[model samples]
Target chain A: MSFFKVEHLTMKFGGLMAVSDLSLTAKEGDLIGLIGPNGAGKTTVFNMITGRLLPTEGKIYFRGKDITGTQSHIINAGGIARTFQNIRLFNDLTVLENVMIGYHGRLRSSFWEAIFRLPRYKSEEKKMRSMAGELLAEVQLDNVADEKAGTLAYGQQRKLEIARALATNPRLLLLDEPVAGMNPRETGDMMDFINSIREAYGLAIILIEHDMRFVMGLCEHLIVLDHGVTIATGLPVEIQNNPQVIEAYLGEPEGA
Target chain B: MSERHRREWIYKLCTYGAIVGLFAFFLQVQNQADEYQIRILNVSAVFVTLAVSYNLINGVAGQFSLGPNAFMAVGAYTTALLTLSPAEKELSFIIEPIIWPLSVLHLPFLPSLLIGGAFAALLGFIMAFPVFRVRGDYLAIVTLGFGEVIRVVANNVQSITNGPLGLKGLSEYTNLWWSWGVAVFTVFCVTRLVKSSFGRAMQAIREDEVAAAAMGINVFRHKMLAFVVHAFFAGMAGGLMAHLITTISPTLFSFFLTFNLLVIIVIGGLGSMTGSIIAAIIITHAGEWLRAVEEPMAIGPFNIPGIPGMRMVVFSIMLILVMIFARQGLMGRREFSWKWFCGFLKIGKRRG
Candidate 1:
């Protein structure tokens, strides 16, 4: 069975269809790239998969269980985690604290236990703290663990967002424009980091990126979309030479 | 037990010890201080509880609720209905006959306070659904509307609440010990709550609700929890204030009362518990001190005629000045700690 699947997913804003009949699938350890031009509804697809938007039509199944229209947090609890296209760190919190919030889904201590500082709360908190610390270390953000998240540099903020996402212990990780704002060197570093974490965590990943060359290099399977419709889906090499994909990117040979 | 558990136990012991010490000190003040000073102190304690609880919702959870006064009304009425004697209830309900069940029952102070807080929390839980649907200024309007609704209900419930004439000649069971003890307990609970992961979740919600939800924090549940917890304390504080004054009416739980709490939290840093504690005490005392400005005064031989509502003007000016200069209020987001205190005093090397 596929590790994750979105079948005929559709989203509508009034008369406008934001995402139309988008079907995709990924297996264990598969690296899928969702690429398109600006306003291609790539983010709309990510939002539907993460339960931020209820699909107007279609099913989103994780491990063969239908998770359509589930609450975002519940969807996250079901072994899926995601980063925002624009960085969404808890800016007022310390870097470590930002990561610790992602561990919230797994913590078992009740609110009363937390209020009373019960033994269970204490032990669980200690476990989460060290785990968050280790995750930060993995992303090379341990040095700024106590610094406010807003104060971190752009690249460091992206790294912290990933570390925080990893703390959820997800089976499927979604990256929405992971290298949105970065220099070429930083982009290269982020690509390597993404590959390493995928290998280390042994999970499926679906990334949305506009940088065609970068997405082509990182993703094993490519899914191309333009105007809320999938134009093509296949291996990176197959997608590179597809006539429809070329026409979608560069307006139909100008005089066909 | 593990070493961590042992340390925590020790910490609990020290906290209780400090509370006991405070209780003893307040008891001393009750005996030695004049009636006016003692009343001021009691009022300060009640306000402290109100301000800190308000921050839990408005500041920490970032809900911007303006219906705390309604919760306070629920609590005040609940406590009054519970603690009033049958004869007192009958006498107070001359405009209409005393309501059944409520008129027949009388509870002691502690239980009455508990039931009052519980009732307020229940109201908060009920309101959470519609209230949480909106955000920003819309939330404020909805909550304000809720407060006005409660006040209107209180005005019409003559058989139960004695109507606009209000309840009077009640027992003054709220002394320094009761008021200040609850204040200490409230501070302890709030401090512990904000320090825990639950508190962190509330802060995360405050920073950004969408991001918090994405991170698997149940946004609605957490918001409701903070609202209910804060309402419970606000209700308890209202109960204390009602008993201390020996009276309550629909007018007592007005928007002005909620505004007073808003001022307290604004003067204290929004997300800082310690700041609320200090700001509550200062603002409560300042309100009383400013009363002198409202009364005519004689300096030496010449007499100065006082402006009746001058205190409010001065307060408004002060609030505006604070907003312009030190907008984060007293503490910003920083908390007070013994270690920080020692460092400020230059008594020891700084520690993280």
Candidate 2:
């Protein structure tokens, strides 16, 4: 069974079809790339899979269970976590607090227990704290765990977002423009961190990126979208050689 | 004992000790204090409760709500109906006969207060369904509308609320002990909620609702929780206010009541519970003390005729100045903790 799958997914916004009949599957431990120019519905796909947006038509499955249009929290609880293209850290909150929020879906303490600070709440909170610390450390942000998220540098904020997503203990992780605004060194560091976490946690990652080099270098398989429709899907080498993909990226042949 | 165990013990001891200390202090003050001082303290405690409860939705949950007074009205009216004697109820509704079921029923203070809070919470829960669907300014307007609707309903319901004349001669059961006790409890519950995972989720929702949802938080549920909890406490505060003031009227729970709470929170810092507590005290006391300015004063040789609403003018100026200089309010999301307090004292366990 596939680890995660999106079959015949389509999204419409008024007159615009944001995603058109897109289908992809990720096996356990696979790294897939969804790439396109600006406005290619890459983020829309992530949004739909995470249940932020209900697909106009689609079926989303995680480990053979239909999760299409499930409530966002339930989808996250079912072990799918995602980051946004625009960094969305709880800015006024500490980095540790931001990650702890990601652990909310896993917490079991009842409202009364928490309000009263019962032993169960204490233990669960402690466990969550340590786990948050670990995730912060994974993203190399443990040293600044107490710092407000808004005070972090842009690259660090992106890392914090990923750390927060990882804190959910997701089996399938969707990263939207993970290294969008990073310098080469920061981008390289992020790529390495992403690779290490995937290996360590046995995560299947589907990432959307504007950086072609990062996508080609990291992703094992690629699906290219243009004008909301898939133009190509295969290994990076095949995509690099495909004329349609080239035309989509660079526009139509000059002579024509 | 282990360090963690020791910390827990210390926490428990400190909490109970503080509660005991407050009771002893208030008990002494209740006997020695003048009626005016007691009244000021009672009002201050109610404002503290109101400010903290308001912060739960506006500050912690990041929903711009403007209808706390509506929930408070629910609590106030409910409590009044429940606690008023059948004879008193008949006397209150002089314009029209008191409703059958309400006129016959009466409850003691504590249970009546709880029921009032519960009713307010129910209203809050119902409001959240539509109110949470909109956000920012729209959320504010919707909630404000809810508040007005409540006021209008209270105005029309002559049999129950006595319409314009309002309910009077209410039992003054809200002593400083009751007011401050509930105020402390409100602070405790809110602070605990803010420190928990649920609190974090609420903050996350405040920061970015979409991102919060993507991170697995049930945004609507947390929003509803914050709203209902806030309304519950606001309701309790209203109940306390009614008993303390010895009257109930539709006009008392107006937008101005919410506006007063808003000013306190804005001055205190929207997301800071400690700020809310401090600001509540400051605003309430300041308003009382400023009464001197509202009265004719002999300054030097000339007797200056005090301007009516001068207190409000000065207060609005102060609020505007605070907004200009300290945009995040006094605390800016910071809370009071033992470590910080100790650090402030220049004593044991200095913050590193």
Residues A67-158 of candidate 2 have per-residue lDDT tens digits of 99899989998999999888888888898999999888778887789999899998999899998888787778999999999999898898
- lDDT at A151, model 1: 98
Off by over 4 Å in 2: B1-15, B298-303, B347-352
Candidate 1 Cα deviation (angstroms), residue B91: 1.1
Q: What DockQ values do the models have?
A: 0.83, 0.82
B115-137: candidate 1 lDDT, tens digit per residue: 99999999999999999999989
Residues B232-300 of candidate 2 have per-residue lDDT tens digits of: 999999999999998888999899999999999999999999999999999989998898889989989
The C-alpha local distance difference test score for the whole of candidate 2 amounts to: 0.91
**Which residue pairs clash in candidate 1?**
none
Model 2 preserves the real interface contacts to a fraction of: 0.87
